[model samples]
Target: MATTFENLLYDLDAATGILTLTVNRPNKLNALNATTIAELGQAIAQARQDGAVRGILLTGSGEKAFVAGADIAELAQLSGPAAQEAAARGQAVFREFETSPKPVVAAVNGFALGGGCELAMACHIRVAAEHARFGQPEVNLGLLPGYGGTQRLVQLVGKGKALELLLTADQVKADEALRLGLANHVVP
Candidate 1:
């Protein structure tokens, strides 16, 4: 089906029964701006409702990031209420993926930090390439993950590991992430 949303960069091929949704803004490392988040939500909803699609793959457009995080430029200007609304919208979108009936896989080829990491965690399964890196560095920016990161990370790695990662605001390599059970599979 043809979609009006261009920023999301969706490619749905009927023959393969695979729907691929790519974060198109490689220049910005495919950061989750309001528009990108909206488009992503729409795309996932469409895919889930479409009967032909058996599986969905979410990925970034470039090798730099699966999604670096939220758009810091846009987020930096938000006031109290605006920030709250942004968080709410993000939560709703990510929740759609988490509860999606069809299987969703995240192909993490690079940096998946903050919201990026949360995005991957929302998927049914995650496959990270050798070059992929994951982290919850929101603390460094004087913010916490506003998009389900705290709960999901704790569920995957337990409270101790989750707290260490969140508190330190450190990046974990793919191997370490797999060892900690943060990733389902790590590939070269």
Candidate 2:
């Protein structure tokens, strides 16, 4: 069965007990805005509470991107304190994967930049499509990845690679990401 939320599409497989959550904003490449992030948190909470759901597979709508990044328009409107709070809220939502008893996996179909990359890092396992790209490019906007990117990236790819990627703001292709230990597997 499937249920559609404002910014998300959820489907559950009774046979496999796998719940798939799709960020449903293909027009925007499933950009992470406050509302979308909140909706994701709600979905996570719901899945955690439902015994029928054994695991979650997180992905984005469309073939072009898993999530391009945060919504620049929405992000640009935040004040200093507002920015801090927003980051906290986003981090909290992503952190659910770590605390949840059920595993959360990320299916990176395309671009996963900034908060998108951060989201992938939160997953217990990550698999990327052949054309997928990953990066933390917040530095281009004079900001840093505030949604656990620093810590998670370090943990996944090690400090040296993490620091280099952060400093360069360079995107890595699926093969490179897998080779660097950023992605567990790559798919066609």
Candidate 3:
């Protein structure tokens, strides 16, 4: 059976007990907005409580991106308290995947930038498609990644490389991601 939300698609593989959660916002390249973040939290909570769900496979809807980044439109409107709250909410949701007892795997099919990269890093394992690209590009906007990207990028790829990427806003391809230990596997 499949459960559909405004911005997500939750499908269960009964035989394997795997829940596939797709970020369904191809028009926005699966950007993480506040509503999407809240929905993800709700879904993760449900998966945690459901015995039928043994693991999770997270991915985006389109071939262009797993998640391109946060919703830039919404981000442009943030102010004092709202910005902090949004960052906190995003961090908390990503932390849920990080601490999940059941494995949470990211299937990175394409661009995983900024918050997208942070989300992928939070997963227990990351599987990237051959054309996948990962990076923390918030520096280009005169800002830093606000959703645990800095810390997780450092943890996955080491401080030197993480700093380089964060500083330059350069992207790494799937093979490089695997070599750097950011991705467990790369597929065709």
- The 0-to-1 C-alpha lDDT of every candidate, in the order given, reads 0.91, 0.94, 0.94
Error of 2 at 82 (Å): 0.7
RMSD of each: 1.0, 0.9, 0.8
Give a tens-digit lDDT track for model 1, residues 1-188.
55666568788888988888888889999889999999988898898899998889999998989999999999999998999999999999999999999889999989999999999999989999988999999999899999999999999999999999999999999999889888899998
Candidate 3 pairs with clashing backbones: none
Count of clashes, each model? 0, 0, 0
Per-residue CA lDDT of model 2 for 1-188, tens digit only, reads 77668999989998999999999899999999998999899999999999999999999999999999999999999999999999999999999865789999999999999999999999999999999999999999998999999999999889999999998999999999999988999999
Write out the backbone clash pairs for model 1.
none
**Weakest 10 consecutive residues, lDDT, candidate 1?**
1-10
Clashing pairs in 2: none
Prediction 2 TM-score vs. true: 0.98
Candidate 1 residue-wise lDDT at 17: 84
Model 2: runs farther than 4 Å from truth?
none
Query: Could you tell me the lDDT of residue 130 within candidate 1?
Result: 89
